[model samples]
Target: MMSFNATLRLAACLSGALFVNAACADQLDDIKKAGKIRIAVAMGTPLFSYLDEKLQPIGSDVETAALLAKDLGVQFEMVSVTNAARIPTLQANKADIVVADLSITPEREKVIDFSRPYAALTIIVAAPKGTVVKDYADLNGKKVGLTRATVNDTMTTQLAKGAEIQRYEDDATLITSVVTGQVDAFSSTPSNLGEVMKRAPQKNWERKFDQKDFLLGIALNKEQPRLKAWINTWVEAKLKDGTLGAIYKKYHGRDLPANVVQL
Candidate 1:
């Protein structure tokens, strides 16, 4: 027969185990139980998420999402989105997080929560091969295409106050309009320009302008402090281990921003 002392010991062990399980389970639980985290990103190539020639999703953001999921101990699900709609998507519950090339502006921060700035980006004007669009001055009285509802669209208008502005829902359409002679030139983010150049290297588009934007950020529900805190910490850890720099090289083929070391 078992002694009474042994029975008490067994019960205490079980109680402690239950408390440990409860304590160890929080954000980690929400992710696993849901099976996937909705990650928002643009569906393109080179810098952000994109399909390779073989149709595999390959980009710095995609890779980063995969690694983040691994670190969080959950599966990752990507939600293809546009620069204009990313915030609404998160706010509307269409996506759980925004991992796109989202710039953290004070205006944007008023509506959404953001992770620590990841990278600094710039906006530029790119023209097709042999076109005369050179700089902002050249764009005067010219027709320029930009992505609708993007920061670039507004900046383009301000820079080319006298120029005709054409707006599209996304980068692909805007670039297409420029490619097919529908517009004189296209103005967009440099990371996106890099993707366009990779897709059509023979076009030999020259960047006539550059607008240095503040750091990029990841978006989450404003109330999700736990998840937001975790992402912020995760980004810091990646920076610590050189993973951020390595990821940048894998996609952009170079080092990070001058301020990355400080990040």
Candidate 2:
């Protein structure tokens, strides 16, 4: 027994919800019709997404995105992005999916949906072998290099007491700063550090300690439930078949760590 105004309001809300659902479905349909999936991946992230000697994009993220598009029976068009561009590209409808090392967190979940984790990351502190960084506590009062606005930066800023943090635009710059003694040590994930080691094993950097575990996922627009579900299924199947592990080893030169998040 609702009043007329209340009944009208409820009907309007329901209509609006239905319209929204219809619009989302249309977007997905358009992508299928186009026969291509635009994947946004982070640029200059070595071992994740970076240009190889041939000036071609070749990295774990790039390969993974290409695989996904192939599975979808569409062409893969890569959209090079930056760390901050991850969500905006999807929000602006400029990309169909973002495979840019996006970590699933409660804060980000409010704006976008994430597929099941495709990779896991462990941040660590690295310094020259003889450096006195035996543990996180030893980082206090020392200069630590990190990429600005990354999870490593946030974790080090929070946990390493009194450490003077020098933020760089990318890991390449941070690695240079670390080697040149601009920073006492560098806080980074293993993927980035592996690239550094390959380029300069003579540096003799040692891992001081591990920082945190982060699960990386494919980020989708919040309204695209169908796309998200498809990606989750795709990831699960690939993980079971060892496709993902092979990709990790291809770029990283080591088997996928056993610490990866289980699907």
Q: RMSD per prediction, one decimal?
A: 9.7, 5.9
User: Tens-digit lDDT track for model 1 on 29-77?
Assistant: 5776898888888765336667787988888888888888888877788
After superposition, the stretches of candidate 1 with alpha carbons farther than 4 Å from their true spots are 1-29, 128-137, 191-204
Report clash pairs, candidate 2. Answer: none
| Candidate with maximal lDDT | 2
Task: Give me the displacement of residue 24 in model 1, in angstroms.
Answer: 13
TM-score of each: 0.81, 0.84
Over 4 Å off, model 2:
1-26, 257-261
TM-score of 2: 0.84
Query: What is candidate 2's CA lDDT for residue 211?
Result: 84
Expressed as tens digits, the lDDT of each residue in 90-163 for candidate 2 is 88989988998877777777877788888867788988788878777898889999987678877889888679
Q: Give Cα-based local distance difference scores for all models.
A: 0.73, 0.79
